[model samples]
Target: MPSMFGRTTKKLVKEIGDQELRPVKCLVSATKIRRFSLIQRKKARSRFWQLPDVPLDVSLMHILEPGSSVPDAAVEVSADFSDTEVMKQQAAGSVNAGAEAGFSEETAVCRGSSLEYQIVSTPHETWTELQKRKLPDPEPYFLKQCREAGVNLYVVTETVELRNSPVLQDHSSMNISGKFSIPLNIFVKGEGQGGGLKVREKKLTVPKGSVVAYKRKQLVFKEKDWGIHHIAEDDDQETFPAGRVQKALGLGADFKLLQEEVSQKVKAAELSKDMQNIVFSNLLAMLGDREALQDLMDKLEQEPFGHLDGPGGTILTELQKDSCYSGVVSKCLILYLLETLMVLSDIQHVLLAQSMEKRILLPQRDLVRSILEPNFNCSENTPFTLQPELLAPLQGEALAITYGLLDECGLKMELNSPRSTWDPEAKEPLCALYGALSVLSQLAEA
Candidate 1:
């Protein structure tokens, strides 16, 4: 396998103050929370950033015992936290949660003297701790006790990891035998913090209101709930084949007959009229003609930028700066091809990992409906035919690393037949059309 990680390893952030503020077992009603995605404007006026404060429901399932841990008294609060009095007022309410614990309504209702009021609230300086975490639905007895004691349960809205934070390394309690697994950034924006663990240092108390804002914090890493359940099922199961994958998606193809077929279709306008089809056809044309790749590169490099305050400018900048694919024609062509496919397919991310069986697997299948889902004219007999030395890197660890490009997008390629008959719902051929879309993207960085 090629040497891993040529770039300097990114440092984990440490200056974040409220990196730990969060929840354990929490309930998030999807219909209850509002999203702030107005940034992606549907039209001219829709792009306005002046969005009104939206309402969301967040209930905490765990809180520190009256004396279990100290409250935040001196940490810098994250500016992203919404503390408008109006928002709190809209959500504010005192409920005698302990009073409704009994099975009999009469017994609970008559407990007038024993009824105690407790308010719902958020905790500062604590990320949702997933260690020793319970289910989303907290036990009734446990919740009642917390209520009667005037403890407030925090519902985590987001969990940010302060990379390289001294708090994580200095504390052994953060993780033990994988029990307190480092909390992944699972609770997404606008949703209630779901099942997780929130921890406060055993000895130190975090100050209130102080939280980490967007800039100083790292937004890398996330948890997976799909394609992973089968990771442990079979040791010898057929995982994704590296030899075929890189060629089919990352490595450019020898269009040949497929190229001619696509050309004829394009000329006749038999192809879909969508922009995706035009782009995909252009890619097929590139793969077939060596001169086309060079011509495309020339155009991109020669394209003038009036002012790069636009969308494609950043991409052009990144493309020019990337020296990794500089000398290799195939690598350069594959990078652009796969990137265009990602946009056309609307597949923001692809999560593939090495399974226990020494095979590749897709762990997250959400958001991967590539529009180029119908154009793999290649056959099962001819996917690749390169020198073994060239092909060697596309197998084993290097191949795994390449698929990771879909996750981290360092970006590469080859040609191979996709098992069109493979499972359609993310297994096997993953829709040979979608697979060929002409295909893949991956993980965020710290």
Candidate 2:
């Protein structure tokens, strides 16, 4: 009896994590010999066991399913002991001949405890069987058992504590009192048993002008929907949380504050008169806020001239530095801002009473208009060799920015003139610029 206990305990300890349980030894009589059998008492319990203290690593048990044609699987058993004493005990089982030997006595000896297992080598056909049987769904049974066994299931670590909390007492009564539970789903990596699921943080690259759909915590883009979502730079690179656009866009919690702030500012004109004029008149120029827009801008402003400019500033500075597309797009945005200020100035002239006009209104309008339309070419300037390649896309973003500003200023743009190809279809300039920067950043990376 002592030898049997030692062998069984040794075998049980060796088969961990793989959700496997193997029978290696059993009790026997002088007249008949019967080997021990490892049976699954719970429908979906694991066939492997975990022993953090053991050096050989996680173990599993393999057994042939009932009605299968294959030979009984090689029951791979193990134990916690460094020596072979336990293995020797498990192998000393009684014989089973043509007689039902007194079963009550043997049952009593093995009644109070059961072996732990991890499913190591599943039958090849088991997946089909599992589809039908659904026997090893880890969520309810196998994971629960591991939790009972004192393994932190979801968090993978190099070292962990392992314990076999008793399900039944030595006297054969249920011992339900002192057990603890795991907090989350146990995560595993690599192979079978409790070793193939993982929670990892991943980064994916997105291309410019692509329409991404959020679903199941992943960003998805269908081939046909690309051009519908207007992006200014169409080449900007952007990063967001994995899946669900709302989450990736930071639309939750404090991020939702953006809408609130925007609403409050637009609703109440608390700013000084000059600030209000500047905000609305040059709204197209401020297609983005300095502080909040920095999030989208940060990605583009990396390396070389990163310290000098953010995304919006970088676009402006780079256009000035490079001779691409004659800096047409950059010029377009600047010109739009200038024209917008001129229009606002004309409006101020109309609104001014003669007495207040010369003292306050006219000088401020002159200063703003001059600043927006700086005379660069009137002086001696180097002629730039422009590249035609970037003209169209840059032109698109510039136009988008203009449209956004007009909307922000609550002003109507006249598109009837030859120079005015301003598309009314373009929405708010700030939003367009946001989209454009996102697109362009993605393009820059590509």
Residue 77's lDDT in candidate 2: 26
RMSD of 1: 27.0
RMSD of each: 27.0, 35.0
lDDT tens digits, residue span 66-149, model 1:
223434232322212211111110111111221211111000000001101111222333333322233332334543443333
User: lDDT scores for all predictions?
Assistant: 0.24, 0.24
TM-score for each prediction? 0.19, 0.15
TM-score of model 1 (CA atoms): 0.19
What tens-digit string does per-residue lDDT give for candidate 2 at 1-446?
12333233334435333222222221111111112111111111111111111111121112112333433343332222222211111111112222222211111122233423222232334323322322232233443453333222111011111123223212211111111121111121111112112223222222221111100011112221111112121111112112332212222223123234333323332333433333233322333243323322232223332333433454445444634444443333333222222222122222222212122222322221222122211222222221223222212223223322333323332211112222222212222222222222222221
Q: Which candidate number has the best TM-score?
A: 1
